[model samples]
Target: MSAAPVIVIGSGLAGLMTALTLAPMPVVLVTAGRLGQAGSSPLAQGGVAAAIGVDDDTSLHLADTLAAGDGLCDAASAREIVGRGRDAIMALESHGVRFDRKPDGSYALGLEAAHSRHRIVHVDGDATGAGIVKALVAKVRETASITILEDCRALRLIKRDDRVVGVCLEGKGPVAARAVVLATGGAGGLYEATTTPLGNLGQGAALAGRVGARLADMEFVQFHPTALAVSAPRLPLISEAVRGEGAILINDRGERFMADQPGQELAPRDVVARAIAAEIDAGRKVYLDARAALGEGFVRRFPGIFALCQEHGIDPARMPIPVRPATHYHMGGIAADCDGRTNVPGLWAVGEAACTGLHGANRLASNSLLEAAVMGLNAGRAIASEMTAATVRLEPVSLPQMSDPAPVRAIVSRGLGILRHETGLRAAICALLPKAGHDDAAAVALAMAVAAFARCESRGSHARTDYPHKNASGTRKLFTMDEAFAFARELAASQPLSRTA
Candidate 1:
């Protein structure tokens, strides 16, 4: 393949938007799965978080994000993202995305948890991600300067000294470029049950770390409060918007348990999910009943969720929907600035793969897509500007072969799911490290292990029973590859011989 001006890993919303923003510049978009299938963007139900309504302001949006994040959100990053939300939403609209509107031509807004006002702009009720991805993919196809390469997974980033040269793909050797953008989504698929696509396995974070990119807040993973508890191997999401539209959580005894919690069904995701999990742990079946609250309008509005419920033989219009906590989004990734530039020169990251400090501890509902668009745009522009000032050269690098991911997946799911203790996490790290040794899957597992070990306190999405108290330090934790390697080695040394590889 010919060397391009920029190489963007993953073809979801963020990667596509990053390429689109650099219009007229030669760009290559790579994906592990087919375009629009690997990331959670296509599975998003609630709309993007934007201050499109007259009642909504950037300040209000920022306040909601900070409150939902439980005091860990960076005020400046929150303000910047919320301030730019309208323009990003308008840009998506300009690209032929059809957002739902009121009868009087105003944008129809939906309310979600921790938000004081209606600010979410969705499409087709549910399936906002689908609508956004469709528009983005269409724009990408029409752009002559952009090339889409499907079934190509980025293995590792190539770095010479402190600068990233290019990335090595699985089947297609090293495709070099002046700049590289890692938008390879999250690690939800690392869990046994998750709403994320099967390939959302933290490859970008791993790739960046292997190249010595600084990673931040890797321990904080958001669990959606209400994923449908189906018999399928992987769990499916039941959108938070459903609760916003008035769904009530009930136990097998027909008790509305959420009434005992703060904000009831409208509580922040971590709070609500824990409550549901507690109910299940207490041997009560949990159900989300929206029949009385939403009525037939539920079927008309959220047709995607409605159909999913029908396929499971549970009609939201008739009875309650069974729900459980499912792995949703990762709040940590390769640490980057607002412009998406990593510590390594010629390397940048955006979307779910980059920890831009926008979603500090926990992300507000639907804010991810907005962050992806805004940051992707900024990254693309910044990379283009940087390339203009220097000569471009393509450097080739070799990638190591990977082993089966089944073992690592099982280890993460059993030891690192919603609730974690020190023993389980340590054991998990020991079991996984050997299997992941020097391979792509191992690199990804190492990042997750390092992050999980660093954060001991129970806060937001990452709850530890051993360290139940929230730490007063409150400083953001960042890790480099060397630091992570040292920590992993130390842990391995402390463990028994059987645990070590």
Candidate 2:
């Protein structure tokens, strides 16, 4: 094994921040693509959320976060994450990110759905993610303590005694490190439609599951409401900030249907996504009407969305954008504390890959960047406090064979996309569990279906159609991969092959 003291297995905000915070400690960063290309962070259009307003306090931010989590958020974790918001903003600024400022010299905060106050910090009006990543990548490249390997993929965790001692890379082989941080991002690619980068197939979660780490909230995948309905692998994302700026959703009949609903156009993502799905399912086409609101300034203020629209041959100034729901983020992941400590010792996770209970069942808009920065810093500091290098031996490894993800992706899109049902979920699992032997995503897909199947009521982003109500009381479920598979096998045994899960 290569003798890097610690190995971070991604190059997004969390991995970069973790390495940067570790400072003098040398860490190896392994990325599957270029430094900022394949990561979901670079594709984020909404800004990071922070309570930096005089009218806003940490308590309000905490309240909003808990409210969005749908009774599943860990109070302490939410407090710690939201409390550290200002410092995270300062830290990002120190790394050379310039947030948009108002005329009076305070931050130009924007409002998103479900937030009671204006507390979102952005950059370049609509290119917050790109701006943040650009600054961070510059800082990381200049730092002498970090070594980067582009196009190197981390395949599995190398555990010696129930603890991750190193990571096994695809072609570069295993790199040994006592502390391994899994900052690999979400699994939105598990479905046919997504706003996430195409490679975000929950590899980190699957690896953690294989190593016996407990996963939570697998059923609560958040779908964004306004992905452009184009025939692309990843649909172009129309930022939620536009809705905050007064854009309204309309169907083919030019009717603003969301006007009658609570929160109007600015409803929480899950509610809006469900509404959009209902429209699409009823053979009605939904559109985002920005022409009347932003008009000419739309092209200037939000060049990213404008460029996307123009590139697709539709002018936002003249016509509304066709829209539909697509998988955006996964709220459930490898359950971890704020320090990013997983159930397995020597293994840590942060960013979208770790379920820190801050997002609960639904992620408040723009809170993901906040989680990545705060929790990444916390993980780095925690690891720095306990630095003891030990000699480790490298073992030969073999990767699991994976087939084309399209078939399973189609199943996930049908059964687990926006709404879920018992029969459809059972069919998805029954189709996937057999294919699980050849593909890793199949297992992750099966896990999600089983988790959705187990939770017999709707809560937050996980809406079960057959069980169309929220349970009176239920805690987050923590289960192993074996347990999920066992449940699948049992369900398959209960019925005939033509009707079984």
Candidate 3:
């Protein structure tokens, strides 16, 4: 270490866990808003997936994860992470998290889509994320070794001799660090309708890619099947647990649309989302009906969702709740190892911002929180053991302009929605390439568009209208900003603009 404090950005679950695990070591935790008030961690409705039930084991959990990943997941990585599922749950509890329990004092595990057993450890029913963050925030605030910087945004990375040394903030200029960790969440905000905090615009991937870090699986974006269909800056998510509880998807004509699907409403998210999108595209409105299933028990099972539905003038116990597919998660990000080590020596990433090949093409339900906690703990230990002392002097670094995702949202949403094609992707790349150099959002969007174009087959969440079938063998794609930009330019020249519709 350079004797400077380790700088952790984003203040979400991964960042907080990383800071806490580095206890007794000096750490500076920075966030764009008040701690626990920003990022997607607090908005997660589902609980953490762990194999702690009587009949469940790590092997079964790994099988479900691999199945959802759609043939692209790294089997070794998935097995290792899933094997540590119980340890991650215990680690969170030690930080003051209170998971819900049954009347017998055992853990109350809930079931979600694609799981073989009931293994979701929740807190306060559907408000699991809020409950977890509340306890962790209180614990983090009281810790003596961690320093919290509120309302600070990271603009770029400061590199020296091919190693990342610090981060340049919006107004605080450059802050030197022994090592830097990026946990800035996912790129769902790049879409018009998303369930993430609007500020999460793939900032981690953009910052890492600008400094030559390899980005992986940029084409796979998961769309949640049941975001409450209403006008808002961020859509409210109706948890998959709702469907797990027997709520069926129905059209306005009262026909159960997913009845004939492989798993019906409980299929993998890509299957359900595509089904709903097809219904809406054909001039029919889709809804989730819990009236015949939950009835009076709806509020007790999912109080948070029930309250949100009430706010929108719909009662789940009486009438079906209108819903549509919305961008919920990104399985692609800065490529890293299980310990969060990136291509660059002193840079690390965890949570949704790091693509460790654990999620592959699609993520299993309730697995995001598990990955975040496990990776954060792994990264902290790795950094403490490997970081070395270096004689370094602070240098003045020029901060880039503050990023605006507004200009890139329409292009990303148009070309990178639930269904994609080559023409829309090429058009998106053509428009985004000009702005990518100066705009962080454009840079991230361009990289995703390039990857989507390169992938000529439909697999998992990446459904291509042009190629409607999966290839015999699926391989993960990785890119750097320079490589993506070069490909975009070549593609723009290879075809006429008139070919894009």
Candidate 4:
């Protein structure tokens, strides 16, 4: 008989690209929701960054990525991934992704934060993610070797003899597989004010950690500086592309507070987010003024954003849009290599779920998509090359209860916001330790809290009030679930509050 099919979790850009790249190889694609309706991929507004411009090159892109990483990025991984930009774009285009172009038939590139050149390749202005996913979804449906299972959530990974062999799906029994690839998105959904899909509550990290996978850089959660400041369950993002189009950030007093700051509106996301957060903390409401810059062209350039504003009874062309920092991305995840191979045998991770070290402590704008596509494709190829025909009967294992993030969301959001401190991190750790065993979200949150507390200095997206400066030497943390829980337990025991309460 043929070997069991490879099981891929999640249906975002990473998962989709992986399955697509593994064509003619039997694969099972799983997702918690409808194929194209789930995850943070479709909600992405910024385009993929590529060094295909006349004045651009891989070295230049790598330099920008490293600069944004704040001395924490793995230089080797950054260079390799940035160098694959043109290839990744071509691969996506071959899979039916048609990027926006100018009348001259050249790619229409847009500028964003931190990049020295206009390297963001978009589609229909702000709908780049949606467009790419739509085309890839259509392609996946036509592929003969891929079997898609929608609305199937992965609860935990099944490991045998120190190797992950399969995954237990929620509401369904174990699905035996030769290998498992996790493409689940990041932990932004753990935040109260976030732009990530509500269902993306760090399940990827939880699943890997439970199965003994090493996770890295868990403290660096990138907050977008300009989410629409409105009452909503999930905040709407005001993409950095708007600022690239010449929008300026102003306060209630109509002061351009970022005017004197280096790079101003175009600084790295962490810098921009902190600036906006500082303004808000000072009791001044912040707004993104696009009137003079885009004016009537606002709707034409960012139709999706324009409509979202209109729905909230605001117009970008005429008035300044209220904005605030919101959790947008997670730079930390399972410590996977360039080919998405985790330390665990037979298991791989890609996209936002895997820490390939390309983004470092913070991600360069638009580079997430580039990394996702490149790594996803690379993972698929690597997995295909390592395919084995050995068939083994899987034993039945008891399935655990489904993971719920509801209880942990408030705890995490309070402590791990744009700004963090020792007190808040410890409190979060204490509250989450007990729940880590049975609750996946709590497990992930507990690990993150520990990482945040251990890092004594502020760097990139992780800012600590007590430790307000960067350390001379920055370190990337790598820990398993056991290590995280042990650290939390030790820390909690030493604290006065834990002893009393």
TM for every model, in the order presented, reads: 0.96, 0.97, 0.98, 0.98
The residue ranges of model 1 lying beyond 4 angstroms of the native Cα positions read 1-4, 389-396, 497-501
lDDT of 2 by residue, 1-501 (tens): 345588898999988899899888888888989997777998888799999899999999999999989999988999999999998999999999999998999999988999999999999888998999999999999999888989988878889877788888888777788699999999999988999987898888888888888888888899999999999989999999989989999999888989999999898899999999998889999999998899988987789999999889999988999999999999988889998999999999999999999988899999999999998899999999985776798878887665688887888988887788988888888888887655778878888889998999888999988988889886787787778888889988886356323
Write model 4 residue lDDT over 126-168, tens digit each, in one string.
9999999999999999999999999999987888888887788
Candidate 3 achieves a global lDDT of 0.92
Q: What tens digits encode model 3's per-residue C-alpha lDDT throughout 1-501?
A: 347788899888999999999877888999999999999999887799999999999999999999999999989889988999999999999998999999999999999999989999999999989988898899889999999999999898989999998888878887888899999999999999999988989999999999999999999999999999999999999999999889999999989988988888999999999999999999999999999889999999899999999999999999999999999999999999888999998999999999999888999999999999999999999988888645466677776676567768988998889999988998899889888988999999999999999999999999999999999877999889899999998988887475232
Residue 426 local lDDT, model 4: 86
Native-referenced Cα lDDT, model 1: 0.83
Instruction: Score each candidate by Cα lDDT.
Output: 0.83, 0.88, 0.92, 0.91
lDDT of 1 by residue, 399-448 (tens): 67766677777878777777888877787777776655565555666667
RMSD of each: 1.9, 1.5, 1.4, 1.3
Which regions of candidate 3 deviate over 4 angstroms? 496-501
